[model samples]
Target chain A: MDIIIKDLCKSYGENTVLDSLNAVIGKGKITCLMGPSGEGKTTLMNILMGIEKADSGAVENMPQNKSAVFQEDRLCESFSAFTNVKIANDSLADDTIISHLEQVGLGDAVYQQVSTLSGGQKRRVALVRALLAEKDILFLDEPFKGLDEDTKKIVTGYLLNNTADTTVVMVTHDIDEASALGADVLYLKDGKITL
Target chain B: MKNKSKIEKTIAVAAALLLWQLASVIIGEEVLLVSPFKVLVRLSELIFEKEFYSAVAFSFIRITFGFVLAVAVGIIFATAAYRWHWAETMLWPYMSVIKATPVASFIILCLIWLNSSSLPVFISFLMALPIIYTNMLAGFKSTDTKLLQMADIFRFSFKKKLVYIYLPNIKPYFISACSVALGLTWKAGIAAEIIGIPDGSMGEMLYNAKLYLATADLFSWTVTIVCVSILFDKLFMKLINTMFKRLEDL
Candidate 1:
């Protein structure tokens, strides 16, 4: 189902972030929202993810089940990567998690606690967690922040392959990221989408 | 490595004991204080006495029961307060009263209201509950919101969320609460017993020594209580540490 957001309005105590924004995200396709920093990209993503409530707007056909790579990694640092993925999965085999990690080049560190992994490794773990989750929608918020160019290519390839045919909304500042993922880009400005 | 450290600690303690004996000999007054050697002799003699064992057992059981009860109730109340603002406001004045009011006053009032045997238990519980509740709630509140958001999005089960996320963050707070409350419970429990004068309790032994002007016995029993309190703290900490280490491994 297409996610139809209409007349979206939001404000934070005299600072308006979004105003009468409207967009339609196609079903089972990657939609990348790109804007300058502080252009309400993250805010819009948060509203769509149901983490932040829109002040006066309506979101239609949002999936009941969603998974995300938040602005932060948001991993359980004390637990192993395997445990984090397992916690999100419902009856998924352990081998499924291992395969996703291997595809993302995280196989060597899958058994290590997230606290012991490097920043890029942790980001990949977070990506694997989102991809492996049983969800109809996936959101990524600048998931490539700490990754180098080569690792980013490998992770982006894995993300695209895993999330293919799954409805995805990603927010990023990099055009290369949008191009690499073959996403339809929506330029966000003054809280409204300009496709 | 562990055994070597333990032996070194034992030698250090022995050296301290010798210094204590030397200081006591130079002072030469039993009422002022007894030497460590004398206290050890008294401790050995008391260990053979049935009354000593009974007193120790009685106090240990009651105080530990009170502590466990307090921990359970504190977590429940703290969770309730976390969920409802009104519950937090309502509990403030009562916790404040408990914190500010003296243990002796509570013991005397409780003596009128409860059986002599139960006074220590009641006092210990009253002393321990508020601190644990406050610390646990603080820990719960400090949990990362972003992580909770991720958990929500992924539809993690309540049990999994608690075990994987909450437990790791809440542990330090729980440990701190236990360490602080354990000592306070012991102090309040024995103080209550002394006021209530319960039979078959360490408090009774101390009181009897006081009445007869047996300063040596008083010091000996006081030392025994100190030893027991330290043992309880060390043993409780060891058990909790081992559990958390295993949990982290899992």
Candidate 2:
């Protein structure tokens, strides 16, 4: 089912973020929310993911089970890469997780703590976790922020291949990222959305 | 570097013992101060006797039980206080009172309310509860909001939240509290035993030695308590560190 946003509006103290915006997020497709800084690209995703509330609007038909790669690599610092992913789906087999970690070029650091991983490596771990989790909708807020050119290409390819059939909404300032994922671009500006 | 530190430690200890021996010789009064050599001799003799082990073991069991019970209660209270604002407010006065009240006063008052045998355990528990509770509560409060939000987004179960999020945050607090509380419980427990004069206790033996002016016996028992307390502290800390090590490795 597609997610429908109807007159979604939000304001913080005095600054209006979403001024009666509306959009429809198609199911099983990649859509990227692109905008300048502080334009509520993340705010809209947070509302849809139920992490934040809108002042006066309705988000309809959002999936019950949601997964996200937050702007920050919110991986548990002391836990292993395997454990961080396992926390999302403990029922998943360890070998499967190893395979996924291998795909992301983190095979050596599989059993190492996330805190020990570099920024790009930690981002890959968070990406792998969300990508492997059992969720209907996936949210990505600058998920690949810190990778170099080569690593970003490999990760972008992996993400595209893996999430081809999943509903993914990503927020990125890099329009090239939207192009690489073959994702539909929605520009958020002035509390309004332009697709 | 390790060998250097070891040599430094040995030299420091030797200097301390030499000063202690010199002080004993200068005093020249057996009633007031027992020499280190004589205390060592008395300790060796006491170890050969059955009553020494029995007394030491008994006190160890009661005090350890009290410390463990207090840890359990402290965790529960800290969790409750973290979850509910009113619970924190309600416990504020009680925590303040327990922290401020003297151990001797509590032991004497508890002696009136409880059996002499259980007095040490109760006192140890009372002394340890506030420290553990306060530290663990601070840990809970300091948990990262971002990680919590990640947990919420992933819909993590309580078990996962605890293992991945809460345990890591609380570990330092828990270990520090245990270190401090372990030493305190031993001191407070022995004090309670000395005052309550429970039969077949190390504290009772110390009281008898004091009453009879047997400074050697007093020094021997004091040395024994120090050894036992240090030994237990080392073992407990090693176990805790190893457990966390395994947790991290996992």
Candidate 3:
């Protein structure tokens, strides 16, 4: 089922983040939201992911089972990359998790603590965690923010291969990245979608 | 550099012992200040005594039991307080009272209600409760909201959330609280035992030493207490770290 945002409004005190926004997020397809900073791209995704509430609007058909790669890595620092990914879905086979980590070029660092990993490596761990999780919708908030172009391409390819049938709502500033994922781009400006 | 620091620590301890010996010599009275040599001899003698093991065991068991109980209760109370504002409000005054009251006063007051054998357990629990509760509460409150939100999005069960997110996040705080509380529980528990004069306990040995003006015995018992306390603290902290390490591995 498609997620329908109807007149979604949110504000922190006087500064409105989402101003009566409305959009349709199609099921089983990638929808990339693009915008300049502070345009409520994250707020929209947060609302859709049920991390935040829209003050006076409704989000219809938001999937109960969802996964996200937050702007921050948010990986448990003391845990290894393999452990971080496995934490999302404990029932996943050890070989499958290791294969996913290897695909993202983390095979050598799979058992090293996330705290010791570089920024880009940590981002991949977060992405892997999100992908491994059982979910109907996947949210990626600038998931590839810290990666270099070469690494981002490989990671994005991995993401595309894994999430072919999963609904994905991604927020990014890079137009090329959105296009690379074959996403339907929606430009967010002043808290409204301008697709 | 680590070896250098170890040498420095050894030198410092030797200097302190030398100073203590000098003080003992200047006093010219064993009752006033027992020499390190005398204390060591007394410790060796005490070790040969049959009652020594029983006394040590008695105090160790009661104190450790109290500490373990406090740890369990403190975690539960902290979780409850974190989940409910009313629980926090209701617990505030009791925690405050426990923090503010003197160990001696609690020991005396508790003597009226509890038997001599149980005084140390109750006193140790009382003394350690507030520290564990406060630190664990802070830990629970300081848990990363971003990680929690991530957990939420991943549809994590309560057990998974606890093991992966909450426990790891609170590891430092829990360890620190235990470190502080372990030392305090020993001190308070011994003080209670001293007052209550529990038979077959370290406190009774100390009391007897004091009453007979056996300065060497007193110093030896004090040294034993210090050694036991340090040993338990290190062992407990190692256990906690190992447990956390295993959890992280999972």
Q: By DockQ, who's the top model here?
A: 1
lDDT by residue for model 3 over B1-250, one digit each (tens)? 9999999999999999999999999999999999999999889999999999999999999999999999999999999999998999999999999999988889998999989999999999998899999999999999989888887777778988898889988988999999999999999999988899999999999999999999999999999999999999999999999998887666
lDDT preference between candidates 1 and 2, better one: 2
Best by lDDT: 2
| Model 3 chain B weakest lDDT span, ten residues long | B148-157
Error of 3 at A148 (Å): 0.7
Sort the predicted structures by lDDT, highest score first.
Answer: 2, 3, 1
Better of 1 and 3 by TM-score: 3
lDDT for each of the candidates? 0.90, 0.93, 0.92
How does the DockQ of candidate 2 come out?
0.79
Candidate 2 local lDDT, B73-137, one digit each (tens): 99999999999999999999999999999998999899899988898899999999999999999
TM-score of each: 0.96, 0.96, 0.96
DockQ per candidate: 0.84, 0.79, 0.81
Clashing pairs in 2: none
Candidate 1 lDDT over residue span A1-195, tens digit each = 799999999999988889999999988999899998998999999999999999998999999989999989999999999988888885879899888889888889889989999999999899988988888999999999899999998998888788878999999999989999889888998778866
Fnat for each predicted structure, in order: 0.92, 0.92, 0.88
